[model samples]
Target: MSYCVGVDIGGTNTAIGLLDGERVAAKESIPTLAGEGPDSLFDRIAATVRGLLGRCGVPGDAITVGMGVPGFIDQEGGVALNSTNLRWRDVPVVARMRERLGVPVAIDNDVRMYVYGEALLGAGRGVRHVLGVTVGTGLAAALVSDGRLFYGGGSMAGELGHIPLESIPYRCGCGLTGCLETVASATGIARQARDLVERDGRASVLREWFPGEGMPGLTARDVSRAYDEGDAVAIEVLRRTGEQLGRGLAYAVTMYSPDVVLVGGGAAAAGERLLAPVREAMQRLLISDYWERISVVPAALGDEAGVIGSALYGRDAAAR
Candidate 1:
């Protein structure tokens, strides 16, 4: 009956949950406010965990904490190697949590924790050789084989989004010009839609949201909704996005040969609107052997995947 805290810390918000075994006993969220530095950020997270623990009626020493974060990580060292979104480098995350929270802490790249979550309890439940893709603000994938998430040398494995594409000159936020994330992620989706709309592909409803040079307010949700209305431009945008995402999946499938590819994150809410194209493109891009066995399904745990996965990972890390 041991309890634990699972933390999913992102650029904008941090999700903290108290779990008893497989169920989330309590959950809460707080802004990361990354510009304030890691100490301040961790301080707020510590406070939030305290609040959740109080609600769960659990004591400090009775539970552990696990965090899923972005960027390169020192899993063994518990330091965030570098996270440009949070402006962090070598931040002593484990040491800080141990001092303030008084519990064992486990940490890894957010997507790794995500796939592990799926491998254990969600879409990939009871399955080995799993691949997970989070297709939201950014794109990332993780590989799990025989119940273990693989972190390649330097903990830099599964960075599928940065796989560059030919002829895409748009400079990615990561300083690359052809990364898959430049066209397949939620940001990429919006960027593509806006670019097309501004380029006179505006016979669609997107023009109401983005008149000439009005890209500031354009978002992927806006585009998806338009696609639901059968707008040709939005359909074209998602078509390209799914095609790119499928291409990325094709490579991962060939390399890892996963049994399932769980597509998670916010944009996944598009469901078949997004995945059908991904499937279609993956079929075209992958070899017949890779295509027939792969099961590309949506992530089942939804928002709680991070929370539950981190908590369970924390519990296991503590035992080790």
Candidate 2:
């Protein structure tokens, strides 16, 4: 059977998988070691792939490899222009992989790969027009329109997280103020919770969760738990974030008019706590005709989306 390998490199963890047709043949995940830098990280990925190939009895010539990584990537040239999370700049990822593995490689933005996974086998299966939104430490989005991923002229078309969010000024990692992610990401939600706790000075329920506290901090999971437990402050944070996400989606709906909007990533783990508010806000903000037409659903592929999508990308590259 023909086989392909997929790698999804994230800020904290890297997931690798092998695919045969539509089934996953093998899968593994490891720490990303962001502090170690790119060369070492790439070496580790190479070693891991070699090990997987050996264990699976897949010959190098029989499989292609694809990698999904964070940040803006020149997929055509196989170069990562800037990955703030990975602290990499102008890294020729695909070239290095090809030199090491002697196998064809495909590379693209991580979120785009997640969307592709949805398009092929998950939430967006059989859907022609889809918008995949990820709300993790950061927010990112991908557009699959008319059965094709739209990479804009500068290869930055699907930067949904960078969409300006009115006048709430705050510098983002991307060097912009008031970007959608400043309010909608997992980091953003925690920051919001911190701000609220500091401002109110009310005995926060989260204090109990932390026990011995240094500085007051709330993780996305903590906020989710607090929301579920009926903490007013946590509920408000998520509600506001959902509103921000809805506003961003409102613009995307106008521009792309996608039929389905798939939400994924860590913050999405809040589930209905996040989605209900987002949907409510979307209904309130969007034009009635459009709001009624679009369906926003959580991504079904979960953590495997990126790896599966990367393998699919490799399959496409091999075909080409």
Candidate lDDT (C-alpha), each: 0.87, 0.86
Model 1 lowest lDDT segment of ten = 208-217
Q: What is the per-residue lDDT of model 2 for residues 1-320, given as tens digits with 9 covering 90 to 100?
A: 37989999988999999888888888889899989988788888888888888888888778899899898899999999999889999999998988888889989999889899888889989888999999988888889876568898978887788887775566897788899998899988887777677656645676677554443556888989988888888889899899889888888888888889999998899998889889998888888888998899999988899999999988887787
In model 2, the clashing pairs are none
What TM-score number comes out for model 1? 0.95
Evaluate residue 291 in candidate 1 and report its C-alpha lDDT on the 0 to 100 scale: 91
lDDT tens readout by residue for model 1, 162-281: 999885657988888899989888888888887777766567788876675656878888888999899988999898889888888998898989988889988888788899999999
User: Which parts of model 2 are misplaced by more than 4 Å?
Assistant: 167-169, 210-217
In model 2, what lDDT does residue 38 have? 85
